[model samples]
Target: MTTTLIFTQLTIREAQRRKILWVGLLMGLVFLALFAVGFHYIVAEMDKYASLEEALTITGVLLTAGLYAVDLLVILMAVLISVAAVSGEIESHTVDVLVTKPIHRWQIILGKWLGFAILLTLYILFLAGGLMLIVY
Candidate 1:
């Protein structure tokens, strides 16, 4: 296999070993659950006095609010993961082993980026899908 692919796999494995993926998934699920419960209650109460048009408008607003919160969480996760990915390795001197390898420096950076990008994409998709399902 290519060096970049190897590094990508290594990065993903490290994240798994650290349980970051599991923690993120658990947190996302909890957020979705809470959002779902709150949305159900609010819509039920709104239904009592609100017209159809008002209900639809309020639903849209609630969905948008949920989306905005998800967006912020995703952004925060991406920033935290990316910031720690390289710096932590360097601080722990793990970069020495990597540098001593035959792989080019750019390959390591690109591989780490690809790994984190894949993770973040999956996370975003999961959270967004959950929100959409709950709202619709």
Candidate 2:
């Protein structure tokens, strides 16, 4: 619905403006750094003694591991993001404006849900893509 879409966009905008978004991203970045280091060490060790096939096998395994790590990170980020969505807006008095608007209650809930769902999906896809690139 248009109402849902508007709220979704509003939620996205609010999320982007907050400092916690960056802090959450910072943690994800740190995780990526550690993943890169671990991956580098693993591949280095493989290159030292592994044959082409063996190295490739190890690479596949590590790639899957990286994906799993990204999965965990994205889920954690989702938790952090969603846990505060409604509560955050209400606490900050931003919802006062929305309350005065012609928006339906279900629209607000659906929009927030859609917003976070999209956000987490994109975040997971992005991290998964990055890890796959590294692995490949």
Candidate 3:
């Protein structure tokens, strides 16, 4: 438990130190910023549809497009982060230090996994919150 928590925290910190987390965060912010600009244009375009049904149709189309774009980014981020995480330290031979630790191998693995999970969660939450801001 303690080992897991420590590992998880370390993993998150490592990602930040390595700038992977920053890249994801920066990407998400860029996405949201672009979305905001697009949303403004969507609102502007909606003005052309004064009828209730037409306005709704335009909004639905625009919103769906925005969602699709976000979906692709999220998926890309997830895949890239996971792949890098699994092989990152190992490829650099940093895992050797952890192997010397008294902790069980499983605990070490679990800790690292937990850490990446937290990173991904934070990334997703940030993007989701941004999306909510755009929607609401």
Candidate 4:
């Protein structure tokens, strides 16, 4: 368990060193900004012509669409991160060091997964929080 935790910490540090977190954050912020501007214009237009109930329904639908986009973004990030992680290490021969170590291979994989999961959770929270703020 301690070994797994060590690998987990290493994986997170590696991601930080690569600036994956910063890139994801920057992209998420840009997405939120665009969503906010578009949502504002949509609400303004709806207010001009939509009844209260209709406006509320449309807003709900728009919010759902925005969430769907966020979901897709999360999926894409996970794929990009996971798909490259092991292969990238192997390609650069970095995995050789871990392979020779006493650690079980599963530990490395699990640690990477956990690290990426943590990152993705934070990413979703940030994006969703910003979206909610924009809507409400």
- Give RMSD to native, each candidate: 1.6, 2.0, 2.1, 1.5
lDDT of 2 by residue, 54-102 (tens): 9888888888888788888887788877888888879999889988988
TM-score sort, best first: 4, 1, 2, 3
Q: Is candidate 1 or candidate 3 better by TM-score?
A: 1
The order by descending lDDT is 1, 4, 2, 3
Task: Indicate which candidate wins on TM-score.
Answer: 4
> After superposition on all CA atoms, how large is the RMSD of candidate 1?
1.6
Q: What digit string (tens of lDDT, one per residue) describes model 3 on residues 41-125?
A: 8777778756778877777776677677777877777676667765777898887887887888788779878887777777777
- In candidate 1, clashing pairs total 0
> Which one wins by lDDT: 2 or 4?
4
For residues 1-136, write the lDDT of model 1, one tens digit per residue.
3888888888878777776567777878998999999999999999898999999999999999999988987887777667778889899999999899787899999999888888888889999999999999
TM-score of each: 0.90, 0.84, 0.82, 0.91
Q: List candidate 3 stretches off by more than 4 Å.
A: none
- Candidate 1: segments with Cα more than 4 A from true spot: none
Q: Alpha carbon lDDT of residue 81, candidate 2?
A: 77
lDDT of model 4, residue 65: 97
Estimate candidate 2's alpha-carbon lDDT, on a 0 to 1 scale. 0.83
Candidate 1, residue 30: lDDT = 91
User: Clash number for every model?
Assistant: 0, 0, 0, 0
